[model samples]
Target chain A: MPELRVDGVTKRFDKVLAVDNASFTASPGRILGLLGPNGAGKTTTIRMIAYITVPDTGQVLFGDKQVGPWSQKQMGYLPEERGLYRKMKVGEQLTYFGELKGLSHSEAVKRVKHWLDRFDASDWYGRKTNELSKGMQQKVQFVTAVLHDPELLILDEPFVGLDPINAEVLQDVIMELKEAGRTILFASHRMEQVEQLCDDICLISQGKIVVNGELREIKKSFGRNTILLDFEGPDGFLDDLESRQLVRINVRSKSHAEIRLLNDTRPRVVLDEALRHTHEISRFELVEPSMREIFVTAVTAQQGAEAIEV
Target chain B: MTNNIFIVAKYEFLKRVKTKWFVITTLLGPMALIAFIAIIGYVSISSLTSDDKTVAVLDATGILFDGLNDEDGQITFVVSNMPEDSVRKAVIRGVFDGYLLLDDQIISGSGEATYFSKDGGGASFFSRKLRNLVRSTVEERRLLEQHVPPEVFEILNARVDVNMVKLSDTGETTGGTEAFAVVGFIMGFLIYIAMFVYGTVVMQGVMQEKINRVVEIIVSSVRPFDLLMGKVLGIGAMGLLQMTFWAILIMAGVLLSGTVVAAFLDPATLNLPASASQDELLAAADFTIPSIEPAVFIWFVAFFLLGYLLYASLFSAIGSSVEQQQDAQSLMLPVMLPIILSIVFLQPLIEAPNSTLAIVLSMIPFTSPISMVVRFAITDIPFWEVSLSFLILVGSFIGSIWVASRIYRVGILMYGKKASFADLIRWARLS
Candidate 1:
């Protein structure tokens, strides 16, 4: 199993700092989600790791060795910008890519057929890439990226433009790869998928990393301050607690409300206060914050800190 | 690395060779050349060997045809003492291809005579010959009437012969400057056209890959320089292949034409004109075409390949930088300017192959591909000059590849924005 590490990497395009001191690690048999907003330098970091571009400072290492051209052969990169020879047949195009990745001619042909069949796209082998739908093209792109079975896979926004069914299929394939002990690093803004798929995460904002660690540990670090309440009868009790400085209601409806307890606030006191006003408290429990809440808060907090510095 | 280059080259060659346009171009060259030569040969042969045409000469004066002999092989005069209206009718009815209505007024200067024929534009070849015969007979009769000897007219009409010979530095002489000019112009023009055609093929090949967005994947697999060189060499080989086909076809066409002409011109069996000696006739009918020297042809191919490489690298760079076909037009002008300038100056080079301007242009990399060929064709160039030109061209070709690979490395991944010359220069500097 391979453990990949990117340490203190910084890249600049002209005067703009595209990636600043970015660092993350993906261990063997695990998936790492690289999260960011648009132009957050996630692609740049991935590119540097793939050896498509050289970082101005720092290094990317696979196992104990520095990443180089040989490392590129051992890795698969599906860049954000997708490209294929539209005039070439799917089988031919995939075979060419496989050969470029150092597969022998016969081996590439065999792999192309096997993968096409796996995806139930055997009939599309003879068709040109442009003749297929976008989703179909994306499937072929995925096949091209993973046909060589690289040890370290870096995919940028891989699940974009996919329907629920295809997205699930890709999610299943990615998990299968992880189970096979491949170290995968994927970048996307879709939190639900990332929360479901990733064992670890490195979140970046405005060309800087805001949070980096295991998914569960990062949520635990934020503390269990969220309270979900299912109540019947009077909803006015929720409005009464809104004036309390220690609690903030993030969402509220007729029978349900999700509340955030401020720093050092106890769950018992909040429960007692909620039951005293509501006719009945059907359910009340303190829970960890959702990934979406963490992401938005972390990014916003980082932005606010930088704004104050200016 | 070299193996990858070869693989890419083989792919490019095989793909283009299989295209229908290549097949059509290869076949069309020989077909069109043969058709052109056949048309010229047919027209000249038909005009020379046409049957005699008979003309009704309505000599109203009755004396115009008195001593005119009908021995001229091309025309026979038919005397008809008829009305002019009927003579015109006879011409229209096809009884005569034409009629000469010579009248008594024609002996005087006050009236005009008319020739009637279906062709109103001008006299036919046969009719012209008849007119010349009448004019000569009338002139002889007038000379005799003036007590002038008819033999004096013969002396006045004798043709003058001017023989031209070219003397080389070794005192070796050749007869025709005209043949040398034709060959030089043709060879120079051929390489000029070839440079543009094959150069643009490379440009468009690069542009196609760039437009399809496949170059980044290819470049990652192999160095951009390797890809550029592979494409250049591949298309260059194709150009050479097509030229080889043309050379073979043209040689066959020329040899067949020569054989046909030789059969018709068997001096021992054919009748000779009364005044022409065998040697003189053969010299006048010289059909031995001048050929390119084997060494010169070898150099031509070398220069052609080098020239294509030099221009194609820049073309590839330009192709990679542009986002679309229309975005390329303004950038193409600078790349094309030198080739166009060379063609514009080709006339002076051909006229004076050893001139200082020609010599200078022939040694410069940009214009050498064309000017040097013109120099090689019209005159024997010094060995040192040819070698120097070769060195310069080869040097520039390598330098272009280095610069082009730099731009190509950066430009292929860039999308949406149209790259200007400044951007290319910036990329070149960065790389």
Candidate 2:
């Protein structure tokens, strides 16, 4: 059974279709990355999934069962609000929240201590949340989301406000949860992180999914004929190369250029053209389109259709 | 559902109590109240002992010196040396609480005496004393005009021991000063304090939860109704606990001040004329001890809880509807107006404890908790109105809970939107 299935969901905030006809499913041991720009219905979708909100016109199912019938204890949701009791002790707050989510008091306490120590924050257990920095608070929030050992974890901006080290630490834990067969879904706009961590990706834009698929399959279908040529010269190579039948170059820097080739293009022709163009072609390598490129390409291309006269 | 309600309530109560602000404020509120009462008591006793009064004697008649001498207390009498302009300046500079101007020039025509004091004769004991002195002086002059000498006049005083006898239309006896009115005021003030404190606490708790976004997290766990009712009842318990502490404190105060209590019951402390006998004193007792029966207190608890729940629901609803403190202020006046109106209009009830208006108002559930408690305290408040008003009060409480719960549900999620009176009406109708 699918770990979670949000089918035919439609949520409108008044006249604004915040989540319009959106649907997706993720199986257990899989991470479904919900990606979108700011105000792109990512959080709203997560909110609906977390049971923080109800969808106006559809059903959210947990495994084979409808989520509406499930107890709050079944799912762990980290809202974008990113809060704990500001004046409460971190350890105490975690245990309280954990217990409220249906863990026994001792179990909650034990889980809190275990997670706190895992993050090397055992010394800060007694300290108030407000005493911690933003990154520390984010760590606390992450622990709160998982402390009850929920089968499903829905995190909205889970790695927000964390340092690079801590973000990676959280990413590792997320991967570990996947391996332990927990259905994990997190929202992020950083496409690289989603690409690295997500098994299935659902990219939402303007309250609609622009892309939804297995991450590896999506990357494979994106094609590998694209080349990033970083070299020294007058840089007219891009303009000259733009006239080619299957070449598309998007935004260039002073020393580097990215090129996407059409399905009909040959890699040998591109290599021949590259060698002929500039002798100072220090790094000319064929590369699969990065998720960042794919995101910018998809979102920009999507936005182009809705452009006004202005 | 019952389990959920109690679970929600227990957590809400524990959570609020554990809050730093609540803990600090709880400690601070009683400390401040006690310190304030003590400071007021100390200041009052000190002022009475200090005798911080400056008297200006014009000596226009130059006849009275005993006026300035209160044998036990310290009073400083300043004989006017400068013109009246200087006295005006001194008064404006707050150099004196007031100054007495004895212009005895008008003494010839029926011994008219003009005593000038700033803000004259407004409840101060000094003004009372000043009036007494002027009257005595005028009486002496009249006695002199007659054949009676000063020594004979002083010896043959006509001090009458006036006794009060209230007669109904059918000639029934009654106590003077309306002992029930005092009971009414005491109960009214207690209810006022309880309602105000608990309402404020409910408001602040809701505001804190909304501002902290803890409501969002908790709503995920529990229903909005559960949260709202839990909060209302939880704070209600806290308020009752505080009132209990106050009751204990008052009993302690009454115990420690045994001498003062003795003065209250002692017939010797009446301070009437020396010639009155104990039998006459007994016949002329001006005040009666208020009998407190268990029934009055039972009604008090019933009405207090019902009335508190009624208004507390509205308070919580108001608090949940608004985002900011300033926004909450606009919502307050409408909710507070009824209780305030009850306090204001039923004030006469405190004066005429068993008047028709007091009885009627006490029967009205809105005003019953306070007005009824007073009537129930001294008089025999009718059993019918007690049961009827209590029934209505409970009905109103249930009705308000329904309305307040509806308001809380929609209002909790409403942000950057000002809910007007009209909107509330619509919300109520819709819900």
Candidate 3:
């Protein structure tokens, strides 16, 4: 099992600090979701880990060894802007990439066939990559990234341009790879996918990591203070709850609402008050915050604090 | 790293060489040029050898007729007591190819002669021949009237040619300097064009890879420098291969054509005119082909390689620094300037190869790859200068590769924005 540790790595592109004091540890067999908005230093950090871009400060280590060309060989990276030789035949392109990754010629040929078959892309073997659909090309790119059986897989926005069915196929493959004990760092904007796939999460904003921890632990630390509620009653209860400051309505609809309980108010107290106003409370339950909410809250909070100082 | 370079180079070479266009161009390019030259030669020769014509002469001075015998049976003079205007009308009516008007003051050097013909430009060869015949006959008659002996007049009228031979300090004469200059100009120009053509191929290859976004995937395993070298060397090797193919093909074509032409023409046509000893004929035949020196050829290859390496690296660097094909033009201009300058200045170099301007330009690495070859062919450049030029060219080549590698390391990964010269310099320095 290999562990990828990024320690206080800083990278500056001209005057912009693309990655500032970014640090995280992805343990073996765990999927680490690198969560960030656009230009949040996600790609830069990944590039550093892949040894494509060197950090200005600090280091990235694989297990006990520092990441260099030797360690780079053990990693597979799918860049955000994925590309392949459009004029090249699918099988030849894969074989060429395999050879570049230091695989023997015969092994590269064999693995190309195996991966194509596994992806149900054997029919694409003789076709040029440009002849395939974008989703098919994505599948081919994925196979190219992992053809070497690398120990560490870094995928940046891998789900982009993928249709739902192909996305599901990729998700299953990533899960299968994770189960086989590969250390995977996945960056994506799809919070639902990250929530389902990742065991650990690192949320970066403005080139800095604001949230980094085990996914369950991070969620637990946020506390289960929000409730999922369903009711058939007057909608005036939402404003009434807001007026009392007993709960804040995070999401609302005609018959259902998700509310965050105030620090001093108890969920039961809010529920009792809601029952008095509504016709019936069919369902009410405390729930963990979604990754989207956590991400938005963390980034907004950081921005607000920074706003005050500026 | 070397292994990666070799692998990349092998791929580049194969990708280009296996293309149908490459094969067709390599095999047919020279053949087309040869065919074009042959057609032009055939047209010129046929026009020159067109049927001999009878010319009506209105020689007011009757003394001109007996002396103006036809030279080489190309023209037959028909004396007619007709007005110049009537002779011109006769010419237009196709009674004769042309007519000549000569007045009574012919021998006293106040004579005016005019040739009348339907086609102005087409009569140039015949006009020259007719003019020579009249001038020589008049001069011979003048010398005889001055009591000069006929033998002395004939001697005075004989044509003389200067034999130019290169002499060493020991008074040893080297024949065929004329052939050497011609061959040199041809070889030097070929190299100039080859460097421009194939060096662009290298640049375009880099640009293609950049445009395709394949550089990122490739630079991951192989170093950027390795990839760059592989591409440059691979493309350069392809250039060499194509050049060798053209050379052999052209050589075979020349040999085969020569034999076919010989077999077609009568042996008597090729035999020397019955006039002189065998030595003069052999000497005239010697002008047919210049003996190629083995040393000069070896130096040609060396210089070609050096020049290709120097320019190709610069071209690759420019390719990497640009964002699009349109951007390449502005960047390519500077690299192309020197090559164009070399060609523009090549005439002066060939005319006076030992001139100071020629020597200095040939010594500069940028221009030397071409100018030096021109100088080497016509004249004997000092051994030291040739070696020094070679050394400087190699040094610049290495320097270019170094600079190119730096730019390549940074540029291949950069996208979106077009990079300026300042940015390229910064990248070369920082990376």
Overall lDDT per candidate, in order of appearance? 0.79, 0.73, 0.83
What is each model's TM-score for chain A? Answer: 0.88, 0.89, 0.91
- Cα lDDT tens digits, model 2, B45-79, are 75444345666655565655444454444345666
Candidate 1 — which residues are off by over 4 angstroms?
A: A225-286, A305-310, B29-190, B260-284
lDDT, residue B294, model 2:
68
- Per residue, candidate 2 scores C-alpha lDDT tens digits across A27-71 of 899999888778888877886776766888888888777665154
Better of 2 and 3 by TM-score: 3
Docking class of 1: acceptable
Instruction: Give one digit per residue, the lDDT tens place, for model 1 in B389-410.
Output: 9999999988988999889877
Which candidate gets the maximum DockQ versus the true structure? Answer: 3
Task: State which candidate, 1 or 3, has the greater TM-score.
Answer: 3
TM-score of structure candidate 2: 0.80
Best of the two (1, 2) by lDDT: 1
Q: Which stretch of 10 consecutive residues in model 1 chain B shows the poorest summed lDDT? A: B167-176
Stretches off by above 4 angstroms in model 3 are A225-286, A305-310, B36-106, B111-153, B166-175, B251-284
- lDDT, candidate 2, residue B353? 68
- Top of the candidates by TM-score: 3
Model 1: residue B326 alpha-carbon error in angstroms: 1.1
lDDT of 2 at A228: 83
Candidate 3 colliding pairs, count: 0
Give lDDT tens digits, candidate 3, residues B1-431.
68778878877887788788799988787977778778989999876664688888888878877888875787888998877778788888999888877778877878777777777525567776787788887787777678887788667768796777865443534467776777787778778867899899988888888888777777666778888999999998898998888777756764565345444444344475666344444444443345556767888899999899999999999999876889989888989998998998888998899999999899889999999998888778778999999999999999999999899888888888988888889999974
